[model samples]
Target: MRKLTAGLFHSIDGVVEAPNLFQFDSFDDDLGALLTGVLGRVDTVLMGRVGYEQWAGYWPNAQVDDDFASFINGVPKHVASDTLTAPLAWQNAQLIEGELLAFVKKLKQAEGGEISAMGGISLVRQLLFAGLLDELTLMTHPVIAGTGRHLFEPGDPTTRLTLVDSQQTAKGNVVSTYARRD
Candidate 1:
């Protein structure tokens, strides 16, 4: 089965929105190297509608996401959205219309290496609830947003996870990788 990993940057308080401004220092060369290595092994990266929209506005020309734009542009990305149609701003992108759980389960069986979900709180919430995620890579920042979009919603239930690895960045970010426990 293909692995679905959730890679996110968040606050220690669990707020996972608009983290770059105050958390830029949290990303360092070591962390960059580690992320690069992880991305290299993944066959595909997926994103939600809003996240895709946000990336569409920026990545095609600039690809601020990484020097991996060439790789990202070429890799298959399955997007979950009710409003988006085909012919995304980025190449090799597709739209998942309905029944996310089955669609993702099928995707996991059909083809590809590790598939990753990188953005959007609503979509992540759904996937998490469906128990589709296999691995999680979280970078916990120090600052808290307190009001922006959060990765985990209020009353979100807890799920068991096995801590596979962890590290502390120079800027106080706690980088941890967890695997969903059966």
Candidate 2:
């Protein structure tokens, strides 16, 4: 079965939204290597409407020399959106058919490389709680983002996860990977 995974640029205070605002200072070569490794393992990308739209607007037209531009532009993207229609403008992107969770469940059964849930906070949360996401990696930057949306909010159901791997980058970013405890 294909593994479904998600990685987030997180802050010490748990903020996962808009890492671009706070992560650049600590984004070092080690962190870049980590992300590149993850990208290498992933052949399919999954994202919500917001991330899809945001990336579609940029990556496709971004300079070819950009590290992520070619990879993101070429990879197959499946977008989960209630409002978006088929034949998305982005190359290799398409709206998901049927129920989101059901579609993911079936996709997991299909033979393929790793399926990555990219930069979609809501989608990652849903997948983690629904037990669909096989792994979650948090590249926790050493900073306190005082105001931003967090990946886990108050009143969310308790979910137990086992740490599978962790490392501290030279620039003080802590990369941690976890798997749900079944």
Return the top candidate by lDDT: 2
Flag regions of model 2 displaced more than 4 Å.
none
Task: After the best TM-score superposition of candidate 1, give how far the Cα of residue 2 lies from its true spot, in angstroms.
Answer: 0.9
Candidate 2 to native Cα RMSD, angstroms: 0.7
Candidate 1: stretches off by over 4 Å: 63-66
Q: How accurate is candidate 2 locally (lDDT)?
A: 0.94
User: What lDDT does the true structure give each of the candidates?
Assistant: 0.77, 0.94
Candidate 1 global TM-score:
0.89
- Give lDDT for model 1: 0.77
Residue-level lDDT of model 1, residues 84-176, one tens digit each, is 877666777888767778988988897778888865677766776788988778888777656566776668788788999999877677889
